[model samples]
Target: MNVKMNGFISLVLGIGLLHTASAATHSLKYFYTAVSGDIDYPEFTAVGLVDNGQFMYFDSSTKTAVPKTEWMKREGADYWDSQTQGLIGEHQTFKVNIQTLKDRFNQSKSTGVHVVQRMYGCEWDDDSGATEGFDQYGYDGEDFIAFDLKTTKWIAPAPQAVITKLKWDSNTANNEHRKNYYTQECIDWLKKYMDYGKSTLMRTVRPSVSLFQKTSSSPVTCHATGFYPSDVMVSWQKDGQDHHEDVEYGETLPNDDGTFQKSIHLTMTPEDRKNNKYQCVVQVKGIKDDFIRVLPDQDATNVVPIIGGVVALLLVVVAVVVCVVIWKKRSKKGFVPTSTSDTDSDNSGRAAPQI
Candidate 1:
């Protein structure tokens, strides 16, 4: 009985270990670098690992996951080990199919994190040696060749989102670190444009005063700007009746880039200005039934108080002038000498003459 029980326990332990290994076989962590010339030597160091089918390679500056396909296609494989050298020696060729590396990464099942790849010591040389003329070196030589990902025969599961295209521009002075940083920035800008395009289209209207004239000789013009195409209507109405005869409406002037703008001029007489019932109606294309009132010009209304003040001032001045004339006439008459005093003096003189 003791022997049988020990055997059963050993069998259980073996099965458990096998299960753990199988689970770990489908995951991997790999490092990739973006180089200018060749896969053997890189110009920039972007070292990270991915495991469990998730991109753990977070860019420190952008705080976002690096695009896997971009790094894979542009930089190629950064993993080089003794086994790879041996395979190249046996085959008498340094070329390895890119699909082979991709398959190896997809099938790895290591549970813990592993540093499967590292890229460093990136340099370039354009000057030729004594025997060669202008030999460009570093990552950009024929020393190493990789299979193009698109032309490869192997196929894997489809990605969640297929990136159709990618484009980038970088300064010549950009090094490995700066290239990675700028790549993240470029990706962010593209995403924002995509989001803007996908959002719903919205319509808006802004009213502006084009011309304001209180005089009847000139017309008061009101314009509505910033209206979208297929959403604009402008007209003039006086006393709730369309006044097309007296109003001159200009054709909608299109912006140089094909945007819509409109202006309406309504000439008013003195009688029309006093009535206070003229309005410029703006109806958006979608909101035809809705009534949107642009602010009416109050210059005509404001003139009433000013005119009343001038009339009152004129009346006060006229009254003051009439009172001053009356006072002057009365003063002249009252200051004149009386003839009675002169007669008494004459009578005294006559009595002296008679004596």
Candidate 2:
């Protein structure tokens, strides 16, 4: 069941590693994937993200890296050409890595599809001048091996990766280079890009908060949209106190306009709803005010809903909850997994040593 569950979810979710939110903190990450089999996916692909926003993309088919955001067009063609050349080299390397992994897992002759993926990047806190980095690799929705900075060794959770771990860990110099690249080089690039997109990247937009229910007996949802920077928190409060139990937290998803949207659901009995004073509170990372939405004081048994959503996607919320819990549990067991995706914010972002 786990294998089937992972395979199915991996097809859709890239991998997400939630980070601590701060108004002044920013990130730069790269996600690369190489695939093997008769899949429709690109043989190799790459994406670059800044603060959860994809700024550039490359694929085997395009063979060139292109900016995704208008603000990133501040650079000349030479800048994109340089990025294109770099990804070309990495793409070739990943092609070989994918085949090597197929053989490593004894799936070279199998009809099944396979993928090799890598995510790495750096983060900086402008407010404190603090810096951090992460680099990890995954295969077929499971952890293969990852760099451990504290021990300066490679960790292999699956038996198949032990051999590679031994070989890679033997390269002390390369390990140090990777560490330095992530901590120093990657961060330098991040700051440069942040400066280039300061008007777009550094601005803060507060969310539009909405409290709605499909039906009186159904779960009430607190939805927030049109937010920038992607660090928004939504929670429910009961009788002037914080409420945690029987609540569901949704992912901060990207909107087409470059802003973000998020929702949280509350499940309460009809009796409890009548007895308690409830409100939904929202806070965007850099916003000064907390957006509050008080629940309508109506009988829980009332048939009409307060808000009308022609299309209610409750199943999406369930799927996100289940997938996150599963991968987190697997991560705790020392086996983190990820998907073959073009987007960096997929469900299974590799658990970096959080380095």
TM-score winner:
2
Candidate 1 local distance difference test against the native: 0.29
Best lDDT among the predictions, by candidate number: 2
State the lDDT at 269 in candidate 2.
89
Ten contiguous residues with the weakest lDDT in model 1: 346-355
Q: CA lDDT, every prediction?
A: 0.29, 0.68
Clashing pairs in 2: 14-346, 15-346, 15-347, 15-348, 15-349, 16-347, 16-348, 16-349
Candidate 2 whole-model C-alpha lDDT, 0 to 1? 0.68
lDDT of 2 by residue, 49-78 (tens): 788777887888889888888878877777
Expressed as tens digits, the lDDT of each residue in 165-277 for candidate 1 is: 11001212222222332233323322332233222122334433244443446566656554543235678777777768677764343232223345677776666666567
Candidate 2 lDDT for residue 111? 64
Residue ranges of candidate 1 with Cα displaced over 4 Å: 1-211, 214-216, 255-259, 288-355
